[model samples]
Target: MDRLERVLKGKLEDSPGASCYWWMGNWRGRGDLADLVLKSRRVLEESGFREGMRLGILMPNCPMVLALSIACWSLGGAVAPMNARSGAEALLRTISILDLHGVAYVEDRPEIGEALSRAGMPSAPCGLEGPLRPFTGRGASELDDPDTAVVFSTSGTTGLPKAVPISHGNILNNVTSSIEHVEFLRPGEVMLNALPNFHTLGYSVSGILPLVGDIAQAILPSFVPADSALSAINAAKVTGIVAVPTMLSMLMGAVLRGGERPEGVSFIISGGDKLNVDMDRRCQELLGAPILEGYGLTECSPVVSINPSYDSRRLGTVGTMIRGYEHQIRDLEGNLLDDASEGVLWLKGPSITRGYFRDPVNTAARFKDGWFDTGDVVRIQDGYITVLDRATDIIIVGGFNVYPQEVEMALMEHPAVSQAVAVGESNSMTGQVVKAFVVLKEGQEASPRPDNRLRQGEAGAFQGAPKGGHPKGAAPVQHRQGEPQSA
Candidate 1:
């Protein structure tokens, strides 16, 4: 048996009656989970699932995701999880790229059914409570690597989605290293798995970590409706939360609107994007838990570094690298830099993937000499990593590099501003100038003219500020929930 199967079986044997997963106000025991995995495996086999094939799963975060993944792995197949919220066109593109043997989707989404039917791909309607119904498609074929456990779809540097196959060994290494590095993942603690399963961070950290680490978890289909999430957290007595910064923001907003804070939360693990300082401070003040921000990329089994604990964490850095990773800092021209310098990050380790599934061009471009180039520019000071910005997101203002996160942080210093995103606008003189889109706090009005206080604050906070004045463009816009406003 693979390590995942061995550990899961051991967990079940050790605690058959212990609650393993909590969903929709009900808890399922470890034995119950084991039975579901067995039933799912039988159903899949009866439906023509075979060893060495890839099965596509289109669903939110739920018990079925874990059940089906375990079942596939046991049968020597892999599971490829696609974003259910991604519309039919995007879903169709993913299906074509992965060339899956079969797919299982939630009962809803008739459009997806239609697309699958048009494409002649075998599919089934799946849910938390029913026997899976089979559909017809091509026969299973042997995979290049039968040890592949999960295949995730991620957009490459060209802005097109590609398939990344993560083996069982990769996941086991990450989970083991993370548990050893972070101290809070104890058996009795309940982790809130609110992030979507389609995201790598969600799958690896929130979804799989708790299971293999023998910790009980509360699973939410989605993180929206913060009031509902809060209820689940309280009901499960959750101790840890792994989510993106935006989810924390929404939960905080709900609290500000008179919702009760979740009880017993020890720490909030924030990743998927840069966690703003204001949001971190607000979490501490309102939720009574410290936000331990982390940094990762989809290609690196999703987690590279994280703030290990509340007592040992530095506010601005993502803490030290996890165990077993060898890293180097490289200049833009590919020359290696000193340990304390700032530049693009390159990583090599057991958890790092070999390459993309079949795109040799992209694989060749990114993976070189056993090191994967993570396109994020970061500064490492005494082992703590401070992610500066994405190399592609940097703007050049008359030969000076301007990091957008710095500008956004400066803009957010104003009390009236609730959120900010900075981008580059074309300018004849500087080649590119900073442009900012600001969202004001509720009941706050934008000033007709630029505020001197804000200007002075920016002058001090932003060292890379373009000469002469504030960012060339500042526009107030309405805040759209869950929609990223980036260039």
Candidate 2:
């Protein structure tokens, strides 16, 4: 058996009756999960699946998603989890690029079926409950790397989604190092897995880490309808939560509106985006847990570093890099910089993938001699990493670097602002200028002098700009109170 299969099989034998996961309002035992894996494997085999094939999955977080992943590994195949909410054209493009042998998607979505048909791909309908149907596509195996366990989809710099194939060893190293670094993820404690499984952070940290670490997981289809997420937390008596900043903000909003704070939550792990300072403070006060913000990317099997504990954590920094990884700082011209200097991050380690799946051109552009360019500009001091902004997201105003996160942080200090996203807008004088989109908290109104309010926020945060005036050649900050921000 492969390494992943061996570990899971051992867990199944060691804890037959222990609660493995809570889904659909019930806690299922390890033995029950094992049975599902076996059944799933049988179904795959019947559909002509074999070693060295790739299986595509388009579904939310559920038992079948986990079961199919394990089943694929047991048969020496890699599983590709795609976003279920993607548009039909995007899904079709991804399917064509992946060259999947077969696909399993939610039964209710007809658009997915149409995409599969257009791609001439084999597919089957899947659900949270019920036996999986055999795939109808003619499965011709192509993948030959037995070490590959999962092929995660990430949006490339060119705007199309690229496939990242993560090896079993890559994931195992990440999980082991993460468990050792965190120190507080004790076995038997329940973790809430509400992030979509299609996301690399959701797949590795929230979905698979709990299983390998002997920690029970509470699964939700998605972190929507905050009531459902809160119910899962209380029902499972969850002790840990892995979420992005948006999810944390939503949960905090729910709690403020008379929802009970989840009991026994030890700590919240925030990744995938910068955790807002105001939201972090509100979470501690209302939800009664410290938010341990971390840094990661999909190419590195999802996790690179995280704040180890509440007491040892530095509020604005992503804690020390985990074991088995080496990092370097490089300037815009690709010259190596001193540790204390700020630049883009380059990573090399056992946990990092070799390259993007079957895309040598893009992979060559990003990876150099085994070192992957993370494209995130960061500063390292005393072994702690403080992410400033994406190298691409930085705006240049009068030859001054304007980091969007700093602007967003300043905007969030306003009482009425709930969330904010800052982007670079084109300017003729300066290369680019800052344009912010603000989301107001419920029942909160924007200030009448919005331009003055933005000027105050920017003036306090950025010293390069004059006190009472806007940044040089910069346009007035734009505000949209109730509009949704695109992901």
Candidate 3:
């Protein structure tokens, strides 16, 4: 049997009385959770959920979400986690794409029911109150298969969501390796998991890691209402928080407005995107814990590397690769580059998924000789990875390359700007140039010439402007004036 199946079954058999989850003001033991999972598995099997079939989970971050997913897998079927925020069209497309047999949801929304009916998909209620069943034998056959454990939905730059199938081996490798490498939390500590369970970050870190490691998980339905998250942290005595940059910023805002800081927080892990330096520093100060930023993608099952909790961590770089993973930098010509040279990042490891669910052409283009092209430009020095920007987002101006992230970071340094996006525009002389659109903070007024309003050193790549108060070979467009900013 695969490690995932063995670990889960062992947990139920050995330590069934241990508290495994804290949700809705109650704690549930491993035995209860295991029973719930088995019952759900029975329900699916009785409803004709056979091996190789896929079940869609339309729930958010709750214990049932994890239960349903594991149950589906235990029954020799895969689970497809559908985004709660997906529209009807997107939902229909995903349902059709995966050929989902049934979808489990908390609430019976008429629209979702109608969409499923139109697509001929069945729906199941998200409930754990069911009759207990005799424990079945280990699902060795399904667990041994190293493909299609979970069909994860990834919203690419431009398209409907792409379904990425992560195998049992892939997630098991990532979760177990990350816990051993990062050492973020101990078994008894509570983990506040407010990130949505549909995303890989949420599923692997917040859902599966806590379960397999025997840590207590306090799950929230959503990340909004920072006060609720803070309360859960305080009430549960949470020791670890897994969140994105925006969630950290919002929590910091709540603390600034008189919300109490969570005591005994061992560490806060930031992922899904790069953590802003300003937000990182402020959140560390506010939460009284170091914010360790990691890097990953949906295709990576989805943690590639994370800062070690017990060692010295680099402030700006995603720490060394996890156990059993390898990385290399490749140039535009597909030639490998030495450490410290910027190029497209390619990763090879057991945790990496084989390919996109049903897109053979894109899959062939992404993978070359078993190495998956990450599409992000990065540099590796001294075993640390510093992500620069996407390969497609690089701007070449006058033969000099510029990454939009650099320009965006520079723009954000200005006190008046709250958010910024830098894009590359065609230029006859320079090949391409950087065009930035920025949003002003509340009550912050911009001068007629934005170039003049920028602080010294704030225009990193655009400092060499020739005329028109803009970068040479570039055109600047003002998208918005002073706008209301959300906390």
Judge candidate 2 against the unseen true structure and give its global Cα lDDT, from 0 to 1: 0.79
**Order of all candidates by TM-score, from best down to worst?**
2, 1, 3
TM-score against truth, every candidate: 0.80, 0.81, 0.77
Candidate 2 residue-wise lDDT, 377-484, digit = tens:
999988999998776654545323445655666677666778877777766434466777888889876665575656545432112234566744445656675773
Write candidate 1's Cα lDDT for 107-217 as tens digits: 765555656777788888887644556666465544557788889886555545677888888899888888888888777888999787877888889989998888899
Screening candidate 2 with a backbone cut-off below 3 angstroms (N, C-alpha, C), the clashing residue pairs are none
Find the 10 residues in a row with the least total lDDT in model 3: 132-141
lDDT of 3 at 133: 26
lDDT of each: 0.77, 0.79, 0.71
Which regions of candidate 2 deviate over 4 angstroms?
393-487
- Residue 57 local lDDT, model 2: 91
Q: Which stretches of candidate 3 lie over 4 Å from their true place?
A: 1-3, 128-147, 155-160, 392-487
Best by lDDT: 2
